[model samples]
Target: MTQPSPNTNQLFKILATGQFGTFLTEDGDNKYVLSMSDGGYEAFTPEELERVCPYTIQIDFMAGGGAHFKVPKDHGLEEGDSVIIGRNFGIVKKLDTRRDNAQTAENLRLIVTQPISTQSPQVVA
Candidate 1:
C-alpha cells in the first residue's frame, strides 16, 4: 500500500515559555509538522532543529493513559523525526499497524527523547 503526504488542515498545539526551537507563529501559514503542544494552534516541522527552547507538554502524554492530541497513521508522518513540544521531545519511534475490528490501522509512536526535564532542582534555603 501507499502512504499519503502531510495535510495542513489538521493541526496541534504546545505550550512554551522561552525560545523553543523553530515554531510557526500564529500569523504565518501552517507548514510545520511539529510545534508547541500547549495550545499552539499551529502545525510544526523539524527540518531545522537549531530553533530549540524551553517547553512543556500541554497534555499529559507521557503517562499511562496516553495523550489527548495524537496523529493517527493518516497524518503522513514517518520515522527519524523528533517531535518537540514545549520542553519535551519524542522521536517517531516506529510505524506500526494494528487491526481494529477488521480495520487495518497505522499509528506513529513518538519516543520521548528529552530524557528528563531540563529544569534544575529548587534550592530552598
Candidate 2:
C-alpha cells in the first residue's frame, strides 16, 4: 500500500515508539522532555566529551516519543509556545524554523525552554 503524502499542517507523526536520549535544537538551546512510553521502545543518548563553555550545562535528557509536528513553510509556530506530548509538557524555548535547503519541504526543528519536572501529564485535548 502507498502512504499518504505529508501535508504542511499535518502532524509529523512518529510511528515508531523509539527514543532520542539527548538531542540539541538546530541552535545551541536545548529542550529536553521526559520519555513517555509503555516500557517498550528504543532509546539512545548522544555521546559527549568533557569540555567547558560559557553557560553550558550537563543534562541527562529522558526524552520519549515526541509530540511532534512540522513547521509550515509560511511559519505559523514560534518560540515560547507550550507543547504537551502525552506525559511530557513544556514550553518552546528555541525555534530553528527555517528551510535552508531545497531538499526538504518543511523544517522540523524545535527546542523547548522549560525543564521536565514532577508534574501532571499534559494531554493535548
Candidate 3:
C-alpha cells in the first residue's frame, strides 16, 4: 500500500520514556515469557535515532507489565518501512489497519504496528 506523504496529516507520533523491556510469549500463550532490557532512545530510522538522547532507562517488568515504547518523528517511515528498534533488536513487520487522521474523531483510533512478529519487516524504498 502507498504510504501517506510526510506532509500528510495522517502522520502521528508515540513518545516513550523510562527503561524499556520486552518479553516473548510461549506458543499459544498470551503472556510474554522471556524478558529483555535496553537504554537510551530508539527511533524508526537512523535519522530519527540521531534525534534521541543517550541515557540509561530503568525498566522493571516484575513490578509492571508495559514498557516504554515510542514512535519518534518518522518523516521517512512508510507503510512498508522496517522500523527497527535498537539496531536489529526489533523490526516493524506491518502496520495495523487503523489509519491516523488528526481532523476527525475516528482518527483517535490508536495506530498499532506489529514489529516483533515472525513476519519479515518491510521498508519502502
Judged by lDDT, which candidate is best? 1
* Candidate 3, poorest ten consecutive residues by summed lDDT: 101-110
Model 2 alpha-carbon drift over 4 Å, by segment: 1-70, 97-125
lDDT of each: 0.38, 0.32, 0.28
Candidate 2 structure quality by residue, lDDT tens digits, 1-125:
53222222221212243332221221223222222233332222222211111221111123632222334434444556655434445554444422222122133333446678899989998
Q: Which runs in model 1 stand beyond 4 Å of their true positions?
A: 1-69, 97-125
Cα deviation at 121, candidate 2, in Å, is 32
TM agreement with the true structure for every prediction: 0.22, 0.22, 0.17
Better of 1 and 3 by TM-score: 1
- lDDT tens readout by residue for model 3, 1-125: 53222321112232333333332222232222223244332223212211122221111233233122323333333433333323222223333223232112121122345657888789999
Better of 1 and 2 by lDDT: 1
Off by over 4 Å in 3: 1-68, 87-90, 94-125
Q: After aligning candidate 2 to the native by TM-score, how far in Å is the CA of 92 from where it should be?
A: 0.9
RMSD to the true structure for each prediction, in A, is: 18.1, 22.0, 23.8
Model 1, CA-based lDDT: 0.38
Score candidate 3 by lDDT: 0.28
Which digits, one per residue and each the tens of the lDDT, describe model 1 over residues 24-48? 3423443454454444443433332
